[model samples]
Target chain A: MKKIFLSLIFLAILTTGASAQVKMLSLPQLQKRISNPDTVYVVNFWATWCKPCIEELPYFEKLQATYKSQPLKVLLISMDFESKLPAVKTFARTHKLASEVYLAQRKSDQELIDAINKDWSGALPGTLIVNGKKGIRKFQEQEFTYDELNKLYQTNK
Target chain B: MKKLVLLMLIAVSSMAFKLADGGYKVGDTAADFKLKNVNGKTVSLADYKAAKGYIVVFTCNHCPYAKAYESRIMDLDKKYSAKGYPVIAISPNDPVAEPADSFEKMQELASKKGYTFPYLIDETQDITRAYGAKATPHVYVLQKTAAGNVVKYIGAIDDDTENTKADKVKYVEGAVNALLSGKQPQVTATKAIGCSIKWKKSA
Candidate 1:
C-alpha cells in the first residue's frame, strides 16, 4: 500500500510537469507549422488574461476533438508577454488544454500581427484556419462559436 | 423594367453591405451620439459648444489595455479640454457580456480614478458599431469642421500598449497636435494588441 501511494504521487508530479511544458516559437517557426501540407492548422492567437479568448477556447477544443480522425491541428498560440510564460504554462495545465500550445517569441506585437495577416488589427481572440495542401486560408479577429469554427474548418478543408 | 429594378436593388444592397463592413474611415464625417455619462447626465458632442474638436475613445473598465492607458487618457483631457478639444470616453462593452464594464462600475471607476472627462456608457453598442471600434482603448480623433466632425485619426492611443511609456509613439496626441498646428497628422492610424470588445449576443 505504501509503495502504491508513493508511485501515484510520483506519477501525478510527472503529469503535472509534462502538462506545464509550453513551447515557445517565433513567427517563422509558427508559419512553418501552419505550412505542413498534411495537416489543417487552426491556429488561435490568445492570451491567458483575455476573457473573450478564454470564452472561445472551448470551441477550438471541440473542433480538435470532432476532427481527431482527420489531420486537423489546433494550435493555441499565446500572445501573453514573455514575462508571463509561467502564467501561460499554469493556465495550460489548469485548463488541461490538449492541443499543442505555444507562446509567441517575437519582439514586437506589430511584426507578428502583420506577418500573420495584414487584415488583423492585433486583437486578442484572432483565429487563422489554414489548409496548406489546398492553399486555403481564412483569418478572423473575433470570438467564434463551435458551429462557426467547424464550418470554417470544413469549408477551408 | 423588372430586370432594371432588380439590378438597382442588388447595387443598393451591395453598397449597404460595404458600408456595414466599414465604420468612419479617416476624413469621413463621424456621427453624433447621445450617451449617459457617469455623472448621470446625457452627454453629446454638440453639448461641448466651446470645443474645436473631440477625442472620442472607446474604452472600458475591465480591459487591462484600457486600464494601462487610464492616466494617459486623463492627461489628454486635462491638456486639451482648455484648448477647445475634450476627451469623450465611451464604455462600448455590453454590461451583460462583461459585468465589470457595467454603468455602475463605470461610475465607480470614474469616481475612484477622479476622471475629469465625461465617461459615457454606450448601452446599446450602436455608437461603438457606428464608430467601428474593434477593441478597448480604440481612439477616434475627430476635428469639428464647417461641414461636420471629420475623423482625423482612428487607432490606438499610443504605440506602447504595455505601459512602459518609454520611446512610445503617441498617435492620438500627434493627431491632435497636428490639427492644432493646422497640419495633417503624419501618422493617421496605428494598431496595437488589445482586448476585444465584449459584444452582446444577437437574438
Candidate 2:
C-alpha cells in the first residue's frame, strides 16, 4: 500500500510538471469567449518565440491567481505557427504555465489580427482586458507590470 | 474650473488613443537618417543618389519572423536595386532588450548572408520612432518625387509570412511594380504577426 501511494505521488508530480493540454481555438471561438457577458476575459496574444511575451507571462499568471474567485479568466493564446505546435507545447511545459493556454487556428495572420483589433498591427504580447458587463474593452500592444495589470482589473471589475 | 477639467480629460483621452495608434500611415513622407552600417560605414538615403527610390525594412537578427523573411529581403534588394529601389534594412530593436540584435551580431549575420544592401543600426531607435515602426520586418516603400521621398506603401512584405515562395500576393513587390508602372498600388498597407520592437526601458 505504501509503495503504491509513493508511485501515485510520483505520477502526480510528473503529470503536474507536464504542460496542461492546450486546445485549438478558432477565431469565432475566441470571439465568443471575449464577448461573453458573464466573465471578464484577459486575453493575451503571445508566442513561444517572443521574448517580451515570455517575460510578461508571470503578470498574467498573477492576475489569474489573484482573481481565482472572481469572474476573471486569463487566456493565453499562442500565436506560434501551426507547424510549431510541438515547440509551443514544450514551452508551456518548460515554463509550467498555469493558466489556460491555447494555440490559435485561423485562415491567415491578417484575418486573425483584424478580428482581434484593427489597431493591433499584429504585434506579439498584445493584451485585451474585456469586461463585457461593464462594456470595458481595453487593448494594449505592450507588456504590463503586475501592478498595472492589477490596477486594470480593479478599474474594470 | 469645470470647463478646464473637461478639457483636460479630453486631452488625456486623446493622448492615450494616439499612443495606441502610433506608427506611420500610408502616404506619409518618412524622414532620412544617417545610421551606422555593418560595413563600418555610415549610410543615408541621400547616399543612394543614383537610385530613384528606396525599400526601407525594419528587421533584426533575433526575431523568428525576421529570420524567416531574410532570403526574401535579400531577393528584394537583388531584384530591385538596379531598378532604382535598393533595400535598406535597419535593426530597430534596442540591443539591451534583445542581446542578439546587437551591432556585432548584426555584422556577423550580414557577413554570413553576403547581404548586398546596407543593414543600418538604429542604435538610439530615434529613426524607428520617427518612422513609427512597431514590429520587426516592417516595410516602407518610398518613391522619390520632386518634393521628397513619398511613402508609397507601408506594411508587410507579403500576404503569407510562413512561406515566402508560396505567397500569392507579394505586397512589397506589388507596390513596387505598381510604382514602376506609374499606378497607385492596389494594396498600400498590410499587417502580419511579428515580434514587437524590443524597446529600451523608459525611465
Cα deviation in Å at residue A145, candidate 1? 2.7
lDDT per residue for candidate 1 within B1-203, as digits (tens), equals 99999999999999866765677789989989999999999999999898889999998999988998899999999999999889999999999989999899999999999999999999888888888888888999999989999999998888777767478888898999999999999988777788888888899
Compute the lDDT for candidate 1: 0.89
- Candidate lDDT scores, in order, read 0.89, 0.89
User: Native contacts retained per candidate?
Assistant: 0.61, 0.78
DockQ of each: 0.63, 0.65
A86-129, model 1: which lDDT tens digit per residue?
A: 89999998888888899999867778988888888777989998
- Error at A87, model 2, angstroms: 1.9
Estimate, for each residue in B43-151, the C-alpha lDDT of model 2 and write its tens digit: 9999999888999999999999999899999999999999999999999988888899999999999999999999999988888887888888899999988778888
User: Any runs in candidate 1 off by more than 4 Å, and if so which?
Assistant: A1-9, A16-18, B1-17
Which pairs in model 2 have colliding backbones?
none
Q: Candidate 1: which pairs clash? A: none
Give the lowest summed-lDDT range of ten residues in model 1 chain B. B16-25
Give every candidate's TM-score on chain A. 0.91, 0.92
Model 1 iRMS (Å) reads 1.2
